[model samples]
Target: MSTEGRSAEPVSATSALESAGFVRLVARADGDGLAASGLIASALAELETPFQVTVGRTIAERSARVDPPTNEDDRTIVVGAADAAADTDDVIRLPATDRPATLEAVDLVREIGGTPDPVLALAGVVAGGSEPGAGESEWLLETAIERGLLEQRPGVAVPTSDPIDGVAHSTRLRAPWSGDLDATREALSDAVDGDSDALDADDHRAIGSLVALDAVGADEATDATAESIGRLLRPYATPDHAFATLGGFADVLEALARTEPGTGTALAMGHDVRETALEAWREHGRRAHAALSSASTGRYDGLFVVDVDDGPVETIATIVAASRSPEPVVLAIGHAEAALATREADSLGATVDGVARELAGAEPETEPAFEDGSEIGVEYDVGHRRSYLRYDPDLDNSTIIAAVREFR
Candidate 1:
C-alpha cells in the first residue's frame, strides 16, 4: 500500500497481517483527484472493507471531514509511514518503512493495547514489505510474545522455539571480531570443518565482529565481503556449507541470495535463512540422518572436487572436461580469484563453492562463446584447477584478481 520503505515483510502479505481479527486499510491522495479516488476505491475493494469511495471534481469539492473520535482510546496514533505524513485522524503513520500491512499496526495496538510488544508491531509491519531489517522484527515480536505482551493466535501462532537470527551486525561491526557477517560465516565454516582458528582477528577492530574473518582462507586480492548464512560468515562466500550437518544448503544460499555483501540489496529467491545448525538439528535431525544414510547407501558416480584460483580460464576448462560426473565439476576458489573464477565457472558450466573464509565463484555454463578475434586457449594436461592457478607462483595477486574478473 505504501512504498515509504515501511512496507511489510518479504514473506507473503499473509504473514505480515495473518490474524483474523486484524483488518487493514490504506488511503493516499495527490494533485490528481481522480487517480487518488481510484486508488482509495481499489484499496478498499482489495481489503474488503465496508468503507465507500467517492470522488469530487476539485480539491475543495472532493471530500468532507470525517467526525472526530469521542474518547482517548479511540484517538488515532499517527505514525509517519516511511516518508509520508498524515493528519491526526489517520491511525498509523509510518515513514519510508510503511506498507499496507503497516495499517495493521493499528490492529496490532488494538490487539495488545500499548503493551510495548515488538512482535505484534513487527507482525503489523511485516504484513507489508517495508523495513530493511535494521532490527529482526519477527524475533523482536516473538520476544515480546515471550514477555507476555501479546497472545499468539490459535493455529496461526508462530513457534515458541528460539530460532537463530542468522547474523547480526553490532555497532562495532568493523571494530574487529565484532560478530559481523564475515566472522559469522567464517565461524560456521570453521566449526563445520574443525578450523575454529579461521578469521583470526579476535578484536575485529575493522569489523568488530566476534568471528575473525582473517583466520579463514582470505587473501587481499578479493574484497573482504563477509559471507555467512546471509553474508553471515565469510563476507564474500556463496552458500555452500555451514557449521553443522546442513539440513538444506539452499537455506544458506537463499539467505546469501537475499542481499549483496556490501550493498545489502535483496536478491530475489525462495525462503529466508533464519535458523542455526543446532535449531535445525533439533527441528529436523531425524530426517537429515535418514536422508544422509540413504544417499550414502546409493550408487553414485565419481565425485570430483576442484579448487581453482587466479589462472587462465583455459586451465579450468580443461579440468571440467576431465571430470567424470555427468554433473559439472565444482570450483572452490579463494577470495582473490572470486571475480575471475566466477567468469571461468560460467564458461565451464560449473557451480561455485565456498565457506566463510573464502570466496567461490560458480555458474553452471561452461560453453565459452568466443568473440570474432578471441582465441581458443587451453593449457596442457592439467590435473586440477588449483594446481593450474598455482603453477606460476611468480604471478602477482593483482593478476589473479584480474584473471578472476575476466575468467568467464
Candidate 2:
C-alpha cells in the first residue's frame, strides 16, 4: 500500500485494516481513549484481524512505543490523539472535541461492517461527561437504553452501588457529611429504606434537599450551589455489567489509567479485571477525598491552584474545576505532574491546549510533551478542556506557577 496522501484525505477504518500488513493501535490511557481502543479491538477480533494496542497518556509517549512500520503495507491507527497524525501514517485520526472518541470509534466499527458495542460507548459517554439531552450524546444514550445496555432511572448521580459509599465518595457534593462514613450513613438514614440496590425518586429528592441545605449553611455561591445540586440530581445511567453504573465504570477506568495504564487497558479490552478495577477505584476515591480535604489552595488571577502532596492530579484537578472552585481554570499540582482543568460550561477565551503550548513556549527548556518525549513538557487532553504538565528539575512547580501568572 502506498502511504502518500493518506493523511490529506479521509480513509475508512475498514479499508486501512484490510490493506495493512500489520496494524498497530495507539490510544491514550484516559477513559475515552480506552473505550475507543476496546471498541476497535472487539471489531478487529470479529474480523479475525491481528493487531496490537498500545495505551499511553501523551501522544509522544504512545507514538514512541511503536516502531516505524517496517513495510509499506503496515499501518498504524491513532485514536484519541489527533496530533499523532503528523508523526506517521494514521489510518484514523479522531480529534479531541466535545464529541468523545468512543462515539467516533462506533462510527468506524459501523463502517467496518461490524456492530458497535453499546456498553463500551456508554462508558465513553459518561467518562467524557457528555451533556445530556443534547446532540449525539442524547442519541447514543437513547440507543443504549433501547438496546438494554443501560437502564435509565430517576436517582442520584453518584456512581457507587451503595448509597452511603456513593455519598461519601462524591466529589461534586462537598457537604459536612462528605468523606465520613458515619456522617454519610446518618445523613441518608431518613432517605434510604433497607439496603436497596438503587435510590428511588423520593430518596434522591430528600438527599438533594439535604445537600442544598448544607450548601446554604456553608454560604456557598448561589449559582455554584445550584450547579452542584443539579449534578447530584442528574438521572443515573445504570449498566448491566460488572460495575453498577456507567459513571462508576468511567471512574474505574480513570483511576486505573492514572495509576496503572496497563491494568486500565486490560480492563477496557474486555478482560475480566473488574475486581482489580474496583480496588483501584476505592483507593483512588480515598486518596482523592483526603487530598481535597487537606489541600493547601492558592488563588491566581485566572487560576485556582491546589497543592497536593500525593494523589491523582487529573482527578483532583477535575474535581476542583467542576465544583470546589469558582475560578474559570483550576490547577492541581504535585511533585511529579500537574493537571489543569477548566470549569464546565465556561472557557478562558482560549483552549487549555493553547494555554499549555504558550506556557511551554515561555520557557526555553520546556516543550510540548505531546510533540516529543521531553522530561519537562505540557500535554493537553482530548476535550481541550484540560492539560497535564510533566514536571522536571528545571521546570519545577515554582517555574510553572510563575509562567502561568505571566500568561494570565
Candidate 3:
C-alpha cells in the first residue's frame, strides 16, 4: 500500500553484477519470471560470472533456496517480484512493468557485452502475453522479424494442438462446447476436415469465425468477449522456436513453469530440454483441465472462490479469474496451498499481496514473521495481479472464506 522507498532509482544490472563477488538470481515460478531470470543467467553464463538461479513464489523463498548462502559481498538479483523494490540496498530488483522483463533483461545482457539468443529473447516476450497493440510487444515482434526468428501469418489464436483440441482447451474462449472434446470436434466438423494439424487460410478463417461466434455467447462482458475474439483473430507472429509458433512456445513455457519450473527455466536458458518440457506441459494441461472441470465454485461479493482437492491451484485460479468467473477477483484453494488472481479491470484497488498479508495476520512491523516458519504466509508474485499463499494443512477452509469475505 505504501509507495515510500519503492521508487528509488534501480542500480544498473551490469554494475550490480560487476561489483559483486558473486551473484544469486531469484525469479518467481512463472513463465515471464523464468524467462527474465533465464535471460540474465544466460548472459552471466556467457560472461563466465559465478551465479546461481533459484525459482519460487517470492523473493524470500527463492533467496532461501540458495544452497551456499550468500555473504555480504554477494549481490542478489530479484526479478518479477511484486514486493521487490529498487531501494532494497542488499538486493537488486527488476520489478514487473507493462514492458516484458525479458526485453529489459535483453538490454542488460547487451550492456554487459553478451549477445542474447534471438529465439530465447522472443520467447520471453511471448511468454509475457503482452497485447499485440502494446508498443513493446510490437517492437519485440518487429525485432524478431528482422532477425528472421519470426514470420507473419494468418492463423487461429488457440495455441494448442489442432483446431478442435485448441478450441476445447482454450482458456480465453468459454464456448458452449468447452471441455467437451466430442462436442468441440462436432462443432468444428464443417470448418475443419479430417486432421487439422496443418490448416490452410480458408480453414483458419472458418475456424476463427466459429470461435468468434462462441465468444459472443460467452458469460463474460461484451467488451471482454470482443477483446478475446480480437486476440483470437489477430495475425500470428509465428516463431521459428522449437515449440513452433510464438503462442505455442508461450503456452509450453507457462505449462512448464506451473508444473516443472526447473525444466521451464532450463528451456528458457537455451537448454536442449524441449522433449522433457513438452511432456511436462502435456501432464500439466491434463491435471489443470481435470482440476478445473471438477472444482466447486462459490461466488462472493467481489470474489469467486474455487475449492479443489488437488492440482495446480495457481493455474486454475488464473483461468477462473481471467475468463470463467464474473467476480473481479478469484481465489483457488487446494489441500496445501491457495492462489489469488485479480482481473485487470478490477476496481477494488486492493493488491492481492495486501489481502494475503491481512489473511496471514502479518503486520508491517513484523514482516519477517513470514520467513520465521509461520504456518500461514503470503507468497508475493511477480505482478500485482496474482498472489500465492501457503497455509497449514490442517487449516479450515471456512477460516479462509471468512478472511476473504472480510477483505472484500
Q: Is candidate 1 or candidate 3 better by lDDT?
A: 3
Candidate with best TM-score: 2
The 0-to-1 C-alpha lDDT of every candidate, in the order given, reads 0.25, 0.66, 0.66
Candidate 2 lands at a TM-score of 0.83
Instruction: Write model 1 residue lDDT over 57-102, tens digit each, in one string.
Output: 1111111222243443232222222222223432332221123323
Q: What TM-score does model 1 achieve against the real structure? A: 0.21
Ranking by lDDT: 2, 3, 1
Worst 10 residues of 1 by lDDT: 261-270
TM-score quality measure for candidate 3: 0.81
Q: Candidate 2 lDDT, tens digit per residue, 1-408?
A: 011123323445567776766677788767778888888888887877778888767655654655667777776767654443345553556654446778788777777777776767767766666644356667777777787777655555555667677667655456666667777788778877676666666766776576667644554233555665565564546666777666667767767777777787788778988777766766777788787778888887777899998887888887777667768778888865677777665432244445466556655553344224555655444443566666443456766776566555
Q: Lowest-lDDT window of 10 residues in candidate 2?
A: 1-10
**Clash pairs for candidate 2:** none
Question: lDDT by residue for model 3 over 1-408, one digit each (tens)?
Answer: 221224224346567676667788777677777788888898888777788787776544664544343576677776664342334555666656446677777677777787776556666665565654256556666666787777655556545547676667554445666667788888888898887767777877888788777757665433455564566564554554566456666667777777788888888887889778766765666567677768898988878899998788877777676667777778899975777877673322245445555655632333333344653444445344666666545557777777667766
Per-candidate clash tally: 92, 0, 1
